[model samples]
Target: MLLQIKRLSSSYGRVRALNGVELNIEEGELVALVGANGAGKSTLMRAISGVQPTNGGGIWFDGADITKVSASKRVRLGISQVPEGRQVFSEMTVEDNLLLGAFTRPRLEIDEDIEKNYVLFPVLKERREQLAGTLSGGEQQMLAIGRALMARPKLMLLDEPSMGLSPLLVDQTFQTIQKLAESGMTIFLVEQNAYVALSIATRGYVMEGGRTVLEGTGQELLDDERVKKAYLGV
Candidate 1:
Protein backbone atom coordinates (compact mmCIF):
# COMPACT_ATOMS: atom_id res chain seq x y z
CA MET A 1 0.00 0.00 0.00
CA LEU A 2 1.18 3.53 -0.64
CA LEU A 3 -0.77 4.72 2.39
CA GLN A 4 -2.51 2.82 5.20
CA ILE A 5 -4.45 3.69 8.29
CA LYS A 6 -5.64 1.07 10.79
CA ARG A 7 -8.06 1.79 13.58
CA LEU A 8 -7.02 5.43 13.61
CA SER A 9 -8.43 7.81 16.17
CA SER A 10 -8.14 11.54 16.88
CA SER A 11 -9.71 14.26 19.03
CA TYR A 12 -10.24 17.99 19.25
CA GLY A 13 -9.65 18.62 22.93
CA ARG A 14 -12.16 16.40 24.74
CA VAL A 15 -14.45 15.87 21.76
CA ARG A 16 -13.45 12.86 19.68
CA ALA A 17 -13.42 13.74 16.01
CA LEU A 18 -12.18 10.41 14.70
CA ASN A 19 -13.07 6.96 15.96
CA GLY A 20 -11.06 3.93 14.93
CA VAL A 21 -11.19 4.60 11.22
CA GLU A 22 -9.46 2.25 8.82
CA LEU A 23 -8.59 3.14 5.24
CA ASN A 24 -6.02 2.34 2.63
CA ILE A 25 -4.77 3.41 -0.83
CA GLU A 26 -2.58 1.56 -3.24
CA GLU A 27 -0.06 3.20 -5.52
CA GLY A 28 -1.39 5.24 -8.45
CA GLU A 29 -5.01 4.71 -7.51
CA LEU A 30 -7.59 7.42 -6.88
CA VAL A 31 -9.59 6.47 -3.78
CA ALA A 32 -12.34 8.60 -2.32
CA LEU A 33 -14.08 8.98 1.03
CA VAL A 34 -17.52 10.58 0.87
CA GLY A 35 -19.61 12.09 3.64
CA ALA A 36 -21.42 15.20 4.81
CA ASN A 37 -20.10 17.99 7.03
CA GLY A 38 -18.56 16.97 10.38
CA ALA A 39 -18.34 13.37 9.30
CA GLY A 40 -14.65 13.27 10.30
CA LYS A 41 -13.47 13.14 6.70
CA SER A 42 -11.12 16.10 7.12
CA THR A 43 -10.02 14.80 10.49
CA LEU A 44 -9.02 11.49 8.93
CA MET A 45 -7.08 13.35 6.22
CA ARG A 46 -5.29 15.47 8.81
CA ALA A 47 -4.38 12.43 10.88
CA ILE A 48 -2.91 10.63 7.93
CA SER A 49 -0.95 13.75 6.94
CA GLY A 50 0.26 14.18 10.54
CA VAL A 51 -1.34 17.57 11.17
CA GLN A 52 -3.93 16.20 13.56
CA PRO A 53 -2.43 14.08 16.29
CA THR A 54 -3.43 10.45 16.36
CA ASN A 55 -4.42 9.24 19.76
CA GLY A 56 -4.28 5.58 18.77
CA GLY A 57 -3.79 3.15 15.85
CA GLY A 58 -1.15 3.54 13.18
CA ILE A 59 -0.37 5.19 9.86
CA TRP A 60 2.10 3.63 7.52
CA PHE A 61 3.42 5.08 4.29
CA ASP A 62 5.73 3.23 1.91
CA GLY A 63 5.91 0.30 4.31
CA ALA A 64 7.11 2.30 7.29
CA ASP A 65 5.26 3.27 10.43
CA ILE A 66 4.65 7.03 10.45
CA THR A 67 2.17 7.25 13.25
CA LYS A 68 4.42 9.57 15.23
CA VAL A 69 6.09 11.50 12.45
CA SER A 70 6.05 15.25 12.61
CA ALA A 71 3.92 17.21 10.16
CA SER A 72 6.90 18.81 8.42
CA LYS A 73 8.61 15.43 8.12
CA ARG A 74 5.48 13.89 6.62
CA VAL A 75 5.80 16.23 3.64
CA ARG A 76 9.25 14.86 2.99
CA LEU A 77 7.71 11.42 2.98
CA GLY A 78 5.62 12.41 -0.08
CA ILE A 79 2.21 13.29 1.34
CA SER A 80 0.79 16.60 0.18
CA GLN A 81 -2.69 17.82 1.02
CA VAL A 82 -4.69 20.48 -0.85
CA PRO A 83 -6.81 21.66 2.05
CA GLU A 84 -10.55 22.43 1.82
CA GLY A 85 -10.16 26.17 1.41
CA ARG A 86 -8.13 27.43 -1.51
CA GLN A 87 -5.53 28.72 0.90
CA VAL A 88 -3.21 30.39 -1.55
CA PHE A 89 -0.74 33.01 -0.47
CA SER A 90 -2.88 36.05 -1.21
CA GLU A 91 0.02 38.47 -0.91
CA MET A 92 2.38 36.58 -3.16
CA THR A 93 2.47 36.19 -6.93
CA VAL A 94 1.10 32.94 -8.33
CA GLU A 95 4.46 31.51 -9.21
CA ASP A 96 5.87 32.48 -5.86
CA ASN A 97 3.08 30.61 -4.11
CA LEU A 98 3.87 27.54 -6.17
CA LEU A 99 7.57 27.79 -5.42
CA LEU A 100 6.83 27.39 -1.73
CA GLY A 101 5.57 23.87 -2.31
CA ALA A 102 9.03 22.70 -3.35
CA PHE A 103 10.89 24.13 -0.37
CA THR A 104 12.24 20.74 0.63
CA ARG A 105 13.40 19.88 -2.89
CA PRO A 106 16.77 20.74 -4.40
CA ARG A 107 16.90 24.24 -5.85
CA LEU A 108 17.91 22.96 -9.29
CA GLU A 109 14.76 20.78 -9.62
CA ILE A 110 12.34 23.53 -8.58
CA ASP A 111 11.89 25.31 -11.90
CA GLU A 112 11.36 22.11 -13.82
CA ASP A 113 8.61 21.03 -11.42
CA ILE A 114 7.05 24.51 -11.60
CA GLU A 115 6.94 24.31 -15.37
CA LYS A 116 5.01 21.09 -14.99
CA ASN A 117 2.45 22.97 -12.90
CA TYR A 118 2.12 25.61 -15.61
CA VAL A 119 1.26 22.89 -18.09
CA LEU A 120 -1.33 21.47 -15.74
CA PHE A 121 -2.91 24.86 -15.06
CA PRO A 122 -2.35 27.28 -17.93
CA VAL A 123 -4.41 30.00 -16.30
CA LEU A 124 -1.92 30.04 -13.46
CA LYS A 125 0.95 30.41 -15.91
CA GLU A 126 -0.74 33.47 -17.35
CA ARG A 127 -1.20 34.82 -13.85
CA ARG A 128 2.28 33.79 -12.70
CA GLU A 129 3.19 37.30 -11.69
CA GLN A 130 -0.21 38.30 -10.36
CA LEU A 131 -0.96 38.35 -6.65
CA ALA A 132 -3.07 35.32 -5.79
CA GLY A 133 -5.66 37.53 -4.10
CA THR A 134 -6.70 38.96 -7.46
CA LEU A 135 -7.86 35.66 -8.92
CA SER A 136 -11.46 34.45 -8.81
CA GLY A 137 -12.46 31.54 -6.55
CA GLY A 138 -12.09 28.95 -9.27
CA GLU A 139 -8.70 30.30 -10.27
CA GLN A 140 -7.51 30.24 -6.70
CA GLN A 141 -8.61 26.62 -6.40
CA MET A 142 -6.56 25.78 -9.48
CA LEU A 143 -3.56 27.53 -7.98
CA ALA A 144 -3.98 25.56 -4.79
CA ILE A 145 -3.92 22.26 -6.68
CA GLY A 146 -0.92 23.44 -8.70
CA ARG A 147 0.96 24.41 -5.56
CA ALA A 148 0.38 20.97 -4.04
CA LEU A 149 1.58 19.30 -7.23
CA MET A 150 4.79 21.31 -7.28
CA ALA A 151 5.93 19.08 -4.43
CA ARG A 152 5.83 16.06 -6.70
CA PRO A 153 4.11 14.02 -4.04
CA LYS A 154 3.86 10.25 -4.14
CA LEU A 155 0.44 10.52 -2.52
CA MET A 156 -1.86 13.54 -2.69
CA LEU A 157 -4.84 14.31 -0.48
CA LEU A 158 -7.62 16.50 -1.86
CA ASP A 159 -10.14 17.86 0.63
CA GLU A 160 -13.42 19.07 -0.85
CA PRO A 161 -11.87 20.24 -4.12
CA SER A 162 -15.26 21.20 -5.56
CA MET A 163 -16.65 23.08 -2.63
CA GLY A 164 -18.27 26.46 -3.23
CA LEU A 165 -17.73 26.49 -6.98
CA SER A 166 -20.26 27.14 -9.67
CA PRO A 167 -21.43 23.89 -11.25
CA LEU A 168 -19.34 24.52 -14.33
CA LEU A 169 -16.13 25.18 -12.41
CA VAL A 170 -16.74 22.16 -10.26
CA ASP A 171 -17.07 20.07 -13.38
CA GLN A 172 -13.83 21.50 -14.72
CA THR A 173 -11.96 20.84 -11.47
CA PHE A 174 -13.06 17.21 -11.37
CA GLN A 175 -11.98 16.83 -14.98
CA THR A 176 -8.53 18.00 -13.97
CA ILE A 177 -8.59 15.53 -11.10
CA GLN A 178 -9.54 12.80 -13.56
CA LYS A 179 -6.62 13.75 -15.75
CA LEU A 180 -4.32 13.44 -12.78
CA ALA A 181 -5.71 10.02 -11.94
CA GLU A 182 -5.29 8.93 -15.55
CA SER A 183 -1.64 9.97 -15.32
CA GLY A 184 -1.25 7.54 -12.37
CA MET A 185 -1.17 9.93 -9.46
CA THR A 186 -2.01 8.38 -6.10
CA ILE A 187 -4.84 10.47 -4.71
CA PHE A 188 -7.01 10.18 -1.61
CA LEU A 189 -10.00 12.45 -1.96
CA VAL A 190 -12.44 13.53 0.74
CA GLU A 191 -15.60 14.98 -0.72
CA GLN A 192 -19.16 15.90 0.16
CA ASN A 193 -20.41 15.52 -3.39
CA ALA A 194 -20.78 11.76 -3.30
CA TYR A 195 -22.09 11.30 -6.82
CA VAL A 196 -19.29 13.20 -8.50
CA ALA A 197 -16.59 11.98 -6.16
CA LEU A 198 -17.41 8.33 -6.60
CA SER A 199 -17.74 8.79 -10.33
CA ILE A 200 -14.01 9.58 -10.48
CA ALA A 201 -12.92 7.14 -7.82
CA THR A 202 -11.46 3.74 -8.50
CA ARG A 203 -12.84 2.67 -5.12
CA GLY A 204 -14.72 4.49 -2.39
CA TYR A 205 -15.70 4.37 1.26
CA VAL A 206 -18.76 5.99 2.70
CA MET A 207 -18.17 7.74 6.01
CA GLU A 208 -20.72 8.77 8.63
CA GLY A 209 -20.57 9.86 12.24
CA GLY A 210 -16.78 9.34 12.38
CA ARG A 211 -16.62 5.79 11.05
CA THR A 212 -16.58 4.06 7.72
CA VAL A 213 -20.07 2.72 7.02
CA LEU A 214 -19.58 1.25 3.59
CA GLU A 215 -16.81 0.37 1.13
CA GLY A 216 -16.75 -0.79 -2.47
CA THR A 217 -15.70 0.05 -5.98
CA GLY A 218 -16.96 3.38 -7.31
CA GLN A 219 -19.58 1.80 -9.50
CA GLU A 220 -20.73 -0.51 -6.76
CA LEU A 221 -21.39 2.33 -4.35
CA LEU A 222 -23.08 4.38 -7.05
CA ASP A 223 -25.38 1.49 -7.85
CA ASP A 224 -26.25 0.82 -4.24
CA GLU A 225 -29.77 1.85 -3.27
CA ARG A 226 -28.77 3.00 0.22
CA VAL A 227 -25.90 5.10 -1.07
CA LYS A 228 -28.15 6.67 -3.68
CA LYS A 229 -30.72 7.74 -1.15
CA ALA A 230 -28.27 8.94 1.48
CA TYR A 231 -25.58 10.57 -0.60
CA LEU A 232 -26.30 10.40 -4.32
CA GLY A 233 -29.77 11.94 -3.94
CA VAL A 234 -31.41 9.33 -6.11
Candidate 2:
Protein backbone atom coordinates (compact mmCIF):
# COMPACT_ATOMS: atom_id res chain seq x y z
CA MET A 1 0.00 0.00 0.00
CA LEU A 2 1.14 3.54 -0.70
CA LEU A 3 -0.97 4.89 2.15
CA GLN A 4 -2.69 3.25 5.09
CA ILE A 5 -5.03 4.35 7.87
CA LYS A 6 -5.81 1.81 10.57
CA ARG A 7 -8.63 2.53 13.01
CA LEU A 8 -8.14 6.26 12.47
CA SER A 9 -10.24 8.52 14.62
CA SER A 10 -10.50 12.30 14.76
CA SER A 11 -12.52 14.74 16.81
CA TYR A 12 -13.35 18.43 16.93
CA GLY A 13 -13.13 19.46 20.58
CA ARG A 14 -15.65 17.06 22.09
CA VAL A 15 -17.43 16.19 18.89
CA ARG A 16 -16.06 13.08 17.24
CA ALA A 17 -15.86 13.35 13.48
CA LEU A 18 -14.32 9.99 12.57
CA ASN A 19 -15.18 6.69 14.14
CA GLY A 20 -12.40 4.21 13.63
CA VAL A 21 -12.32 4.79 9.90
CA GLU A 22 -10.01 2.47 7.99
CA LEU A 23 -8.90 2.71 4.35
CA ASN A 24 -5.90 2.36 2.11
CA ILE A 25 -4.67 3.17 -1.38
CA GLU A 26 -2.23 1.23 -3.51
CA GLU A 27 0.29 2.85 -5.80
CA GLY A 28 -1.26 4.14 -9.05
CA GLU A 29 -4.83 3.65 -7.79
CA LEU A 30 -7.58 6.23 -7.64
CA VAL A 31 -9.78 5.54 -4.62
CA ALA A 32 -13.02 7.47 -4.24
CA LEU A 33 -14.79 8.09 -0.97
CA VAL A 34 -18.44 9.05 -1.38
CA GLY A 35 -20.76 10.27 1.33
CA ALA A 36 -23.25 12.95 2.27
CA ASN A 37 -22.37 16.18 4.06
CA GLY A 38 -21.20 15.67 7.66
CA ALA A 39 -20.15 12.14 6.83
CA GLY A 40 -16.55 12.84 8.02
CA LYS A 41 -15.10 12.58 4.52
CA SER A 42 -13.08 15.77 4.85
CA THR A 43 -12.09 14.87 8.37
CA LEU A 44 -10.60 11.63 7.18
CA MET A 45 -8.60 13.48 4.55
CA ARG A 46 -7.37 15.98 7.11
CA ALA A 47 -6.36 13.24 9.51
CA ILE A 48 -4.42 11.46 6.81
CA SER A 49 -2.61 14.69 5.98
CA GLY A 50 -1.95 15.26 9.74
CA VAL A 51 -3.84 18.57 9.84
CA GLN A 52 -6.57 17.14 12.01
CA PRO A 53 -5.70 15.56 15.33
CA THR A 54 -6.23 11.84 15.52
CA ASN A 55 -7.70 10.79 18.80
CA GLY A 56 -6.57 7.24 18.19
CA GLY A 57 -5.30 4.93 15.44
CA GLY A 58 -2.36 5.29 13.07
CA ILE A 59 -1.46 6.57 9.62
CA TRP A 60 1.34 5.10 7.57
CA PHE A 61 2.59 6.59 4.30
CA ASP A 62 5.29 5.26 2.03
CA GLY A 63 6.30 2.63 4.63
CA ALA A 64 6.69 5.12 7.50
CA ASP A 65 4.35 5.88 10.38
CA ILE A 66 3.10 9.45 10.05
CA THR A 67 0.35 9.60 12.61
CA LYS A 68 2.20 12.27 14.55
CA VAL A 69 3.91 14.02 11.66
CA SER A 70 3.44 17.75 11.16
CA ALA A 71 1.38 18.96 8.22
CA SER A 72 4.30 20.66 6.44
CA LYS A 73 6.49 17.62 6.96
CA ARG A 74 3.77 15.46 5.46
CA VAL A 75 3.84 17.62 2.35
CA ARG A 76 7.61 17.22 2.16
CA LEU A 77 7.09 13.49 2.48
CA GLY A 78 5.07 13.52 -0.77
CA ILE A 79 1.56 13.78 0.62
CA SER A 80 -0.37 16.71 -0.83
CA GLN A 81 -3.96 17.74 -0.29
CA VAL A 82 -6.13 19.89 -2.53
CA PRO A 83 -8.50 21.05 0.15
CA GLU A 84 -12.20 21.63 -0.31
CA GLY A 85 -13.32 25.11 -1.46
CA ARG A 86 -10.29 25.52 -3.79
CA GLN A 87 -8.69 27.85 -1.27
CA VAL A 88 -6.10 29.45 -3.52
CA PHE A 89 -4.26 32.53 -2.25
CA SER A 90 -6.71 35.11 -3.55
CA GLU A 91 -4.30 38.06 -3.58
CA MET A 92 -1.30 36.30 -5.15
CA THR A 93 -0.59 36.02 -8.83
CA VAL A 94 -1.38 32.58 -10.19
CA GLU A 95 2.27 31.87 -10.81
CA ASP A 96 3.26 33.07 -7.36
CA ASN A 97 0.66 30.85 -5.69
CA LEU A 98 1.87 27.91 -7.73
CA LEU A 99 5.51 28.60 -6.91
CA LEU A 100 4.66 28.44 -3.21
CA GLY A 101 3.69 24.82 -3.62
CA ALA A 102 7.28 23.96 -4.52
CA PHE A 103 8.74 26.04 -1.69
CA THR A 104 10.53 23.10 -0.14
CA ARG A 105 12.15 21.97 -3.39
CA PRO A 106 15.29 23.35 -5.00
CA ARG A 107 14.67 26.67 -6.70
CA LEU A 108 16.10 25.27 -9.94
CA GLU A 109 13.26 22.77 -10.18
CA ILE A 110 10.49 25.32 -9.66
CA ASP A 111 10.25 26.54 -13.25
CA GLU A 112 10.08 23.00 -14.56
CA ASP A 113 7.19 22.23 -12.22
CA ILE A 114 5.40 25.39 -13.32
CA GLU A 115 5.79 24.39 -16.95
CA LYS A 116 4.32 20.99 -16.19
CA ASN A 117 1.31 22.76 -14.67
CA TYR A 118 0.99 24.92 -17.77
CA VAL A 119 0.91 21.79 -19.88
CA LEU A 120 -1.84 20.39 -17.68
CA PHE A 121 -3.81 23.63 -17.49
CA PRO A 122 -3.17 25.96 -20.41
CA VAL A 123 -5.51 28.58 -18.99
CA LEU A 124 -3.15 28.89 -16.03
CA LYS A 125 -0.33 29.82 -18.36
CA GLU A 126 -2.45 32.61 -19.88
CA ARG A 127 -3.49 33.87 -16.45
CA ARG A 128 -0.14 33.33 -14.78
CA GLU A 129 0.17 37.01 -13.99
CA GLN A 130 -3.40 37.55 -12.86
CA LEU A 131 -4.50 37.52 -9.24
CA ALA A 132 -5.89 34.16 -8.21
CA GLY A 133 -9.13 35.74 -6.96
CA THR A 134 -10.23 36.71 -10.46
CA LEU A 135 -10.47 33.14 -11.78
CA SER A 136 -13.82 31.40 -12.04
CA GLY A 137 -14.72 28.65 -9.57
CA GLY A 138 -13.65 25.93 -11.94
CA GLU A 139 -10.45 27.78 -12.78
CA GLN A 140 -9.63 28.13 -9.11
CA GLN A 141 -10.18 24.42 -8.58
CA MET A 142 -7.79 23.70 -11.40
CA LEU A 143 -5.28 26.06 -9.84
CA ALA A 144 -5.61 24.31 -6.51
CA ILE A 145 -4.88 20.97 -8.12
CA GLY A 146 -1.97 22.54 -9.97
CA ARG A 147 -0.60 23.96 -6.74
CA ALA A 148 -0.70 20.55 -5.08
CA LEU A 149 0.90 18.94 -8.11
CA MET A 150 3.78 21.34 -7.82
CA ALA A 151 4.75 19.30 -4.79
CA ARG A 152 5.07 16.23 -7.01
CA PRO A 153 3.29 14.11 -4.45
CA LYS A 154 3.29 10.32 -4.40
CA LEU A 155 -0.18 10.29 -2.85
CA MET A 156 -2.68 13.11 -3.38
CA LEU A 157 -5.69 13.67 -1.16
CA LEU A 158 -8.37 15.48 -3.08
CA ASP A 159 -11.26 16.74 -0.98
CA GLU A 160 -14.30 17.45 -3.09
CA PRO A 161 -12.54 18.73 -6.22
CA SER A 162 -15.96 19.01 -7.88
CA MET A 163 -17.75 20.71 -4.99
CA GLY A 164 -18.90 23.96 -6.62
CA LEU A 165 -18.90 24.10 -10.41
CA SER A 166 -21.25 24.17 -13.35
CA PRO A 167 -22.28 20.83 -14.81
CA LEU A 168 -19.91 21.24 -17.72
CA LEU A 169 -17.00 22.32 -15.55
CA VAL A 170 -17.65 19.44 -13.19
CA ASP A 171 -17.40 17.07 -16.11
CA GLN A 172 -14.23 18.77 -17.23
CA THR A 173 -12.73 18.55 -13.75
CA PHE A 174 -13.57 14.86 -13.52
CA GLN A 175 -12.01 14.24 -16.90
CA THR A 176 -8.83 15.89 -15.71
CA ILE A 177 -8.86 13.68 -12.63
CA GLN A 178 -9.43 10.62 -14.79
CA LYS A 179 -6.43 11.55 -16.87
CA LEU A 180 -4.36 12.02 -13.76
CA ALA A 181 -5.33 8.55 -12.58
CA GLU A 182 -4.57 7.09 -16.00
CA SER A 183 -1.08 8.54 -15.67
CA GLY A 184 -0.66 6.59 -12.38
CA MET A 185 -1.24 9.30 -9.79
CA THR A 186 -2.36 7.75 -6.51
CA ILE A 187 -5.46 9.79 -5.67
CA PHE A 188 -7.71 9.43 -2.65
CA LEU A 189 -10.81 11.36 -3.64
CA VAL A 190 -13.54 12.50 -1.27
CA GLU A 191 -16.67 13.42 -3.18
CA GLN A 192 -20.40 13.78 -2.68
CA ASN A 193 -21.28 12.92 -6.26
CA ALA A 194 -21.41 9.21 -5.61
CA TYR A 195 -22.65 8.27 -9.05
CA VAL A 196 -19.91 10.09 -10.90
CA ALA A 197 -17.26 9.19 -8.35
CA LEU A 198 -17.95 5.48 -8.47
CA SER A 199 -17.95 5.56 -12.23
CA ILE A 200 -14.25 6.44 -12.49
CA ALA A 201 -12.76 5.13 -9.25
CA THR A 202 -10.95 1.81 -9.30
CA ARG A 203 -12.29 1.12 -5.80
CA GLY A 204 -14.61 3.07 -3.49
CA TYR A 205 -15.89 3.36 0.05
CA VAL A 206 -19.19 4.71 1.32
CA MET A 207 -19.37 6.68 4.55
CA GLU A 208 -22.30 7.48 6.78
CA GLY A 209 -22.26 9.68 9.87
CA GLY A 210 -18.66 9.01 10.92
CA ARG A 211 -18.17 5.43 9.78
CA THR A 212 -17.27 3.61 6.60
CA VAL A 213 -20.33 1.49 5.96
CA LEU A 214 -19.33 -0.10 2.69
CA GLU A 215 -16.37 -0.78 0.44
CA GLY A 216 -16.11 -2.31 -3.04
CA THR A 217 -15.12 -1.80 -6.61
CA GLY A 218 -16.70 1.23 -8.34
CA GLN A 219 -19.21 -0.83 -10.27
CA GLU A 220 -20.19 -2.75 -7.17
CA LEU A 221 -21.05 0.39 -5.19
CA LEU A 222 -23.02 1.86 -8.09
CA ASP A 223 -25.14 -1.28 -8.16
CA ASP A 224 -25.38 -1.81 -4.39
CA GLU A 225 -28.93 -1.55 -3.08
CA ARG A 226 -28.10 0.70 -0.12
CA VAL A 227 -25.67 2.85 -2.06
CA LYS A 228 -28.02 3.07 -5.04
CA LYS A 229 -30.91 4.15 -2.84
CA ALA A 230 -29.08 6.48 -0.45
CA TYR A 231 -26.39 7.90 -2.69
CA LEU A 232 -26.94 7.09 -6.39
CA GLY A 233 -30.69 7.62 -6.28
CA VAL A 234 -31.22 4.41 -8.22
Q: Which candidate tops lDDT?
A: 2
Please provide, for model 2 over 36-87, each residue's C-alpha lDDT reduced to its tens digit, 9 standing for 90 to 100. 9999999998888888889898999999999999999999999999999988
Identify the candidate with maximal TM-score: 2
- TM-scores for the candidates: 0.98, 0.98
- C-alpha RMSD values across all candidates: 0.8, 0.7
lDDT of 1: 0.91
Residue-level error in angstroms, candidate 2, position 186: 0.3
Considering only N, C-alpha and C atoms within 3 Å, which residue pairs clash in candidate 1? none
Worst 10 residues of 1 by lDDT: 45-54
Residues 185-225 of candidate 1 have per-residue lDDT tens digits of: 99999999999999989999999888888999999999999
Query: Local distance difference test, per candidate?
Result: 0.91, 0.93
